[model samples]
Target chain A: MIIYGSERVEDLSLRCDVVVVGSGAGGAAAARVLAAAGAKVVILEEGGYHTSFDFKQREREMLPMLYRDRATQRTRDRLVNVLQGRCVGGSTVVNMADCARVPRAVLEHWQRDFAVEIDTADFEAASERAEAALGVAEIAADQLNANNRKLLAGAEQLGWRRSRFHHNRTECTGCGFCLMGCAFDAKRSALVTLVPAALADGATLVSNARVERVVVRGGRAVGVQGVLTEEHGDRPAARVRLEVAADVVLLACGAVHTPLLLQASEIASASGQIGRNLSLQPQLPVLAVFSERMVSFRGIPQSAYCDEHLVFDPRVGMTGFAIEGIAGGPVQTAGLVGASGRDHKRWMARFAHTGSCLVLVPDQPAGSVAADETGRTRIDYALQPDVEQRIRDGARAAARLYLAAGAEVVVPALRPLTEIRNEADLARLDDVAVNPDATTLLSAHPQGTCRMGEDARRAVVDSRGRFHGLEGLWIADASVFPTSASTHTMIPIMAFADLAARSIAQARAARTI
Target chain B: MIPEIDRRTFLRGATGAGALLVFGGALPLGACVLAQASDPPPDLAVLSPRAWATLACFADHAIPRGGAFEAGASDVGVAGLVDGWLVGADSRLVTDLRRGLALLEWGPLLLGFAARPLTALPPESAGAYLASLTTSRLGFVRQLHAALSELCLLAFYSTRSAWRAIGYDGPIVLGLAESVELERR
Candidate 1:
């Protein structure tokens, strides 16, 4: 049963076998599996409950509704955005639904560096199950929009190895509104699939209930307590104190928020890594204006990716990056073009002819997230040198691709090369810096904040997703990733979440907790 | 001193460092807006007419009157849209914006003109002034330019006026996917 916590007359004090905080890719998957395993479960989501029908393709209308802080949650310097969903489905509602498995290299990094025990084959098996559950499949050749086609053609012409991405949707109508909360419910996010399935199996869900702190006693978690506010409004008329006690408290809040909650609860990691090692998948969109109408917004937003330039060699402290097709409605597009008034107006004047590709640079864990005394999530993140270098390389490649794709003018993320019309202009990209003032930057993926590993000293949780030295306290989200995935994070997060649930369920069957 | 506007903290892309916090953080929104917090707006609807006109003149120059575009920022009520967005914004931020505009009004005084409202300036003068602020070595002027530029661009394009200017036909409406597929068929 789904209940709006604020509507209740009295304080809410509930008991359950398991209580999962957050309902994104990780939490929803765990909620479904744990509840199916016959554990009476309750899920508390900080954001409101909204199904597919609730989505409006309008950026202004939808951003403030579905995203945390209206998709404006920025780091300390306000250069990088820690974008994630805050609703019942979490970021799965707002993301582009790119389902990438944990690559072999990333997994090996975890195994070798963090002592993560999962072998490649078992991880792949888990990934297959996750994909099956998520309805992950490749886009048909017919679904390729003009924008994606141009991007693909450019990569092929350059002899770059590009591949089509697998998305969770069964049939996409190509409205290009995935970022605005999938209006058609076609994007089978956790909201439409696992969350609903979990609700059907007798799991109770209370929305707009923010978990303040893990109620701990003698170094073990007992319950969680926080206030419930109005769903549609920021200011609560009368806040209701909502509390839930359970055998397991699984925090699946994303990297930006999970650590904030942990810090608020005084659950400091032994290694002092509670809010450290934040991984931001720094993404910058490089736009190209074509002579013909591409109308990039008519189809799936991101379907093709080019890893030809994504070079990662951990031994030498270099993780490469890739570029993918990106679509933006008016508001988002205006922001991506840069800070110039004339340049912005000029670009939008020919908007229909614009095709854009986003460069995804895999940044290492060089940031942190914490909650201050006011219970507000505070993030301090800055990209390191290697990540910046990768972006420079990627931007140059992106400019060439656009030029190759018959673009009349290419707008690389670099400020000076605002309008690159030819291959000669591409060389100017080398001087481009990764500073936000120099480029229009964004980040869709936030990982490794509350990283998992075996040693309690170096990580927040054990490999079983159990918080180190804290019984019945676990985390199932991207917060548990030991390293950056270097790709879209939905599937890997789901697979790991499912694996964590299986481990927890098996342990519970043996009365382990 | 930064007055920390975490609640509904909206940063514009064109206005500041691409990702630098103009509020609380390592860079505490220019070491506290206290330095410029002298004159404050009087109403809950904070912008005064002079302030409104200042943005108006600046907006016109930002987009300028030209090209294939049917409407500019002023026609699209961009200044008003931005005003509405700043309704509940932190007073310090609004004050900073107000000071930024006021400086431009009198900034020409630095260039040997009497202190007059920015709205009184010609389009060429206003455009030159804005560009001067953008290229200014002063951190204060650069930050103000960043905020104003982002706000104008975002608010302008966000309006229905800039939709056709950019080839965006507005919201795709229902059955957008199905209709596209059917059209293909």
Candidate 2:
């Protein structure tokens, strides 16, 4: 049964075998598995219940309706804008639908550095299950839009390594509104896939219910208490109180909110890592103006990626950078122009002729997430010296790629390097100071806040996703990643959550036996 | 965008500007200019009258009229739209935004760039002052410029009236004749 918290008149109390504290990629995936195993699961989603019909394909309406903090959540320094979904399926409902597994090198690095051991065959099986569930497949050659084709042609001309990405979209209409939300239900996000499957298996979903804190009894999580909110325009007004008692509590509130929830609940880990080790994987947008009309807003937003600069090391895991084709609506694109007055208008005037890509750089776990004195979530992340250099290199490479592909002018999203028409202009990048407020950076994948490993002294959760020092508590989100999972985190997160849920089910079955 | 100016440049030039502001006692100049009579929109939901005027002035300069597009941010009432949007935003963010707007308003006089507040300056001077903020040596000042500029640009470009100038065909789904409607939850 699905319950809209706004419609409830009085306080609600429920008892269940398992209570999933989020409805995102991990929570939905775990709920499906637990429900299929005959566990009475209750999923509490802080955001509203929205489906394809709610998607208006307009940023003005959809951004506030679908995203957390109206798509304006930023780091403490206000440098990188951290975009995450707060609606029914979390970020899965609004992501680009790119599906990638945790790179083998990254997994090995985790095993070596974080003492995390996973059965390769089991993980592969879980990944296959996740792929099958989401209908993951390679993008066809014909599906490459003009914006993406530019990246491909540039890489081919430069003899660089580039490849098409796999996506979870089926019957996509090329609406170019993937960042907002798929209105046609083309993307098989957790909203349409596991969320519905879990519901079909008798898992109850409560929407517009914000889980405030976990109720612990005798060192074990017994339940969660929160408030029901009703939508008043774009704001959610607090209303009735909600409480759910459960034998097991699974937190899947992404990396940012999960740690905040733990802090609010007064849950501490032996490793002192409850809200540490945050990896943002920040990306910079680079736009190019082509002479011909690219009409980038009409087709698929992201389809191809160039990993010529991407590197993986046995000692440090994923490093270097990646350049992927990207495009957005006018509102989002204009924000990246980094110009004022006439210069800004001149750039926006060529919106139809612009092709863009994001320079994604993998960084070490150097950031942290904590609540401030005002109880507001604070994400502290600053680009390290190496990461900053990688971003500059990636930006220059992306500019050259666009120039090689017949762009008239390449515009890095930074104020200092506004226009790069030739190799000479690229020299200007060498002297650019890459600090906060100098450019626009975004983070769609935030991981490693409550990282998982074997040793209780260094990890917040065990490899099986159980809390190290607590009973009946588990984490199934990107928060459990010991390092950056991959360029995209959907498939890896789902695979990990699937394994964690199976372990929980096995335990439940053994106890009953 | 303006050329990049790092902190060293600002620090190198700060002595002169600091002396002019400190010894010249130019801080009250902005207050005197702001004290002049002005009318503000009555239907504003969140921003104060002074903040609304400051934001309106900043938006006009950030996206002035008679440029690539005939309709600028002020023409589309971008500041009013922002005020309405801020109604639903976090209190901390709203407070920060108001402070940023206040800084922009009093920046020219306090920084010794002009004798008048931003709202009292001519359009070209206001535009130049706002552009200077983008290249300011102070990180927070540059951030203020970026935050306000982005907010204005977002609000302006999202309007349907600005679509033709940008060569965008708005949302394709809205134009479809027979759109498939999903079952509403």
Candidate 3:
């Protein structure tokens, strides 16, 4: 059994029944399935195993320790700096524990439009298994943090329906460090859940390995070739290239990079639709200040959202949007507030009591992910006209809701406001030109980079995740998501991975017979 | 139908052929692996001394002792902390942190002027110097002071002490049993 941090094996040509790359939710799910089915599985992860004990609260140290690109990989085109985990648990280690089921409509759309024939019954069954495996459940009302309560208060004042959101947490100690890698071994990340289960069921995990290319022969994936990168304290690190033959190769590198891999392989020749139609359902945050100590810091990170205007209804498209409650520390708040000198001091002073809510808009699938001249990712996306208007309208609604909840000031991302001292000040937001260029837009759901469809010319992979016309090659991450769903994408991606693993297992059994 | 499938098949072949070309052309042993450097361990302390000083001053400002400014600005192993933080490992923010510290000389200048080390200066003088640096337009002093202040606040708030100072009731200590069990795991 290969636990994390094992010394290098001298030999290069190692064989395995299956090889899963990237130990995120999706990859981990697939690894567990294959290992449990009594297959020799070798899971290669680029990041090392990180435990809660190693979770430093400091961003300067922790960012490099846990996150990819050291948390400095900014969207050069947009005013957003994305952060994703690079450790054994992947993003799950640092993600706020919000587990929402895939919206039924999204599944229906997948079936009707995309030739993926997963019905409501199949989806429900898959979701049930995934939820059970993940220990997913709702947060009780009594467990609602001060931040969540304020969001509820605002929702109540606005006469909007609200309820506690579910999470994958088993016994959350109410630690504010969920978004910054939980220090207490409370949040159930893949590092704790699927990876461990997979290991226990006889899986071989090789950390510090980077897969460069998947070798294919006669339209079949033969194996993979990559380097194992290790950092020696001061000596200029070590790199050893690896060549492994496997029966099946699962690509779970993630949306942003999977397309790069495929493009590197020059595999999208049929229609060259390999890395197209990237959707980063961009989100903008709005902070509301209250006189009373909201203490928005201590709670589940994001537990609710205003769905009042959420539907196929175009009127609600950008009309109004606000989440349960979004909170962070003073430095993070200062970065967002973008004020210097005494005004910044004032913002920091009220940081303890400041209530924050993010307004997210489902960007109408308009972005493109392409490699630059230097072959690095160049994510270029412009807000559509309707999307820009929706942001302004949504921001205004958030301001009104805050004021209704007795907030003294509403600091919107793109509005000019001295402070909302009275209810009449809400009207000023209408004229506040919410500049899409200037306003902060972050993306958690990066999907459709490697889309699945009926036509091989249109999609990189088929409905079952197999690379189109290729044997023993499949993608099992957010890259396989044909389109972005309304809510979070982690659970849905993991479900799809589980389904893909089942298909691979059935194929393997059939071949053996 | 044949062309479409052939295109897909040909694409797969091209991918395989590309990998084969790279593998075939490369000098297997000496080329792929980068040459390892055998340089002496840097006086890790030498590179980041200025950054350490700035961070030390900043930490002092944020968590000074007593009610008074000079009297209260406290000091711990902040220099050592910053030094450790700078050289410990690879991080995006702190990659050239020591290099960035050269831009802020307020901490070093104050350290030079103090009756004792800036870490050991009387709380009153420390407070006064901090205030002057913030308020005065002494170009280098102001710039360095501002930088130190910013760096310190970030460092302090990010540490366990910030949580303690703010009365945040998050986890602080690990239980003995848990530590032992972790060792086993």
CA lDDT of each prediction against the hidden true structure:
0.75, 0.84, 0.63
- Sorted by TM-score (best first), the order is 2, 1, 3
lDDT of 3 by residue, A380-460 (tens): 666667766776777777777777788888877541233555667766665555442234566666777788866788777
Quick one: ranking by DockQ, best first?
A: 2, 1, 3
> What is candidate 2's local distance difference test score?
0.84
Better of 1 and 3 by TM-score: 1
Candidate 3: residue A286 lDDT (0-100) = 81
Give the alpha carbon lDDT tens digit for every residue of B20-93 in model 1: 22221232112111111122223426676556666766676666645556577656766666676665443545
lDDT (tens digit, per residue) of candidate 3 on B51-79: 34444444555445433121212333444
Indicate the residue-level lDDT of A314 in model 1. 62
Q: Score residue A420 of candidate 3 by CA lDDT.
A: 54
Candidate 1 chain A, run of 10 with poorest lDDT: A230-239
lDDT of 2 by residue, B1-185 (tens): 11112223243434444444344343323322222223566798998776777788877777877677787876677888778766676666675675566667768877777887686777667767887887787776776777778787778887877898889988866633324333231
User: Which pairs of residues collide in model 3?
Assistant: A304-A324, B64-B72, B64-B73, B64-B74, B65-B72, B70-B123, B70-B124, B70-B127, B71-B123, B71-B124
Candidate 3 Cα misplacement greater than 4 A, ranges:
A3-13, A231-238, A313-322, A370-376, A413-418, A431-437, B1-156, B159-185
Better of 1 and 3 by lDDT: 1
- Model 1, A1-513: lDDT tens per residue? 988875776788999988999999999999998988888889999888887777867665576678776665667565676677878899999998888887787788787889677767877887898888888889877888898899899999899999888899976888888998887888989998998888888899998888888899867887898888776643234477888988888999888888888878888778788888888888878989999999998899898888897665765222777989988887777766653555566677778888999988887888888765544567777778877887878888888887888999888655554678998877777667776456546878899888888888888898768888888899998988887887888998888888888888887899987
